[model samples]
Target: MRKGADTMQRASDSRTKTIVVVTIGVLILLPAAYGFIEKLTLFILAVKRDLIAGFTIIPVVNYLIVTAGMACLLIWAVAHGMFRRIEQPKYTMLEREEEIDRLDASENRTGEDR
Candidate 1:
């Protein structure tokens, strides 16, 4: 009975944590997204009326294209699970380094014997 209660408590805690994180993210991201959208709308209107200079439009379009490309890349990475095992690469790198050190030590020992 105590174990079951503890499990329930843990589950509740996890849910609360997820809710808090999502709430905070929404609070932060929504405003920034709104601002960007507002600016984009104004920029589009300006371009439509040919109010913006050609040089200015070129840079703005380039920025939009790069932002879109990066957003797509981020989506692709998330879908491919690139962020799931964020620490796995560090361990793999350390393991490779250890293997290389061992091989070098063995080579040195053999050279000393010869």
Candidate 2:
């Protein structure tokens, strides 16, 4: 009886893992598949219309615009100190909290002495 229960639990766990993997795969692939299909459709339409030059130039322009935008964002982040001593802020916060607690404790001790 105990062996049968163990076998059933293992089967359930396997099924759950398979389902989770399938779900994650679908979530990741569905958007990528849709984008591919959309681009293919647009390329076919452009070819049909003989506007291949515009289609080619548009993708290049889009790539440039996206690159520039990302560069600007990165510059802004650096200018604002987003990447400066990333771990320092976390430790600083903890230290500040500890200092405040120490001050409060000292204040309480002084008050009791009076």
Q: Pick the candidate with the highest TM-score.
A: 1
lDDT of 1 at 16: 100
Residues 1-114 of candidate 2 have per-residue lDDT tens digits of 999999999999989987998899799989988996798688667767886446586675687699789989999997998975679988999999999999999999999999
Candidate 2, position 19, lDDT: 100
Worst 10 residues of 1 by lDDT: 46-55
- In candidate 2, clashing pairs total 0
lDDT per residue for candidate 1 within 1-114, as digits (tens), equals: 999999999999989987998899899999999999999898788778785444588888899999999999999998999977689999999999999999999999999999
lDDT of 1 at 91: 100
TM-score for each candidate, following the candidate numbering: 0.61, 0.44
Give lDDT: candidate 1, residue 49: 79
